[model samples]
Target: MRCLIAEDHLLSRRVLKELLSPDFDCDIAVNGREAIDSFVLAHEAKRPYDVILMDIMMPEIDGMEALKSVRSLEKKMQIPSHLAVKVIMITALGDPHTVIKSFNECEADSFIVKPLTRHKLATELRKLNVLK
Candidate 1:
């Protein structure tokens, strides 16, 4: 599967890529703006990403805003049935309010806390049916 990872922290991005390398084709974005641009480009290129891992805090644009934009585009474009994209919010903040907001407001497929263990991430992927 193809995945897009957006994080401002370089180390965190690297760690996520390393963890997902064995199971997915990964693309890295340094900030939310880059992430959105990359996502749009990939979609336009007819190679839409299967999943997106988004960090809430970022420069140029925040993950929540980026996700809203992505959803808007998806709605406006009336993306075909075959081009479904799932987005997962990944961040260090474990605030219940934020988690609730992410789910209610951003419509994320799932949320994951940082310092992610391989097992935890794998379990999430499996639950989402992105992994077998």
Candidate 2:
């Protein structure tokens, strides 16, 4: 699978890539704008990302905004709902409001708490059927 990791923190990005690299061909974006551009580029290349791990707080644009924009792009392209990119919000904030916004408002496929572990990520992916 192809995956995009959008995060501002270098260590976090590194750790996530290390964890996911074994199972996926991964791309890294330092911020949300880069993430958006990468997503569009991949789509235009006819190889859309299967999953995106987006950090909620990032420069240029926040993850939430990027998520909304990505969803809009998918809709514009008329991609079927089941085939649309699966976005898993990665955030430090686990408050109810943020959870609701990410899942309900933005339609994120799933979420991962900060200080993420391989086990947690794997569990979420399995729950979403991105992994067996």
Candidate 3:
């Protein structure tokens, strides 16, 4: 599977890539803007990502905005929600409002808290059916 790790923190990106590299051919984006650009380019190249691990607080565009834009692009391309690229919203925030918004408003396939571990990553990926 192909996955995009969209995060601003170098350590966080490194850790996530290390964890996912076994199962995923991973791409890194330093911020939401790069994430969105990569998403579009991949689509245009006919090799869209299978999943995106997006950090909510990012420079340039922010994950929430990028999420919305990505969904819109999927819709424009006639990709149904079920067939759209899965998004696992990654965040340091644990507040109810943000979590709720990430699910209800942003329409993330899953959410994982920061200080991420192999266990947490596997559980969410399994739920999304991206991992066994």
Model 3 agreement with the true structure over 1-132: per-residue lDDT tens digits: 899999999999999999999999999999988999999998998889999999999999999999988898899999977789999999999789989999888888898887788999999999989898
Clashing pairs in 3: none
Error of 3 at 93 (Å): 0.4
- TM-score, prediction 1: 0.94
What lDDT would each prediction earn against the true structure?
Answer: 0.87, 0.93, 0.92
- Estimate, for each residue in 61-103, the C-alpha lDDT of model 1 and write its tens digit: 9998888888878888798644657888988888999899888
- Model 1: pairs clashing at backbone N, Cα or C within 3 Å: none
Q: Report lDDT (Cα) of residue 124, candidate 1.
A: 82
- Badly placed stretches (over 4 Å) of model 3 are none
Better candidate by lDDT, 1 or 2 = 2
Which TM-score value belongs to model 3? 0.97
Question: Per-residue lDDT of 79-130 in model 2, one digit per residue for the tens?
Answer: 9999999999999999989999998888899988887998999999888777
TM-scores of the candidates in the order shown: 0.94, 0.97, 0.97
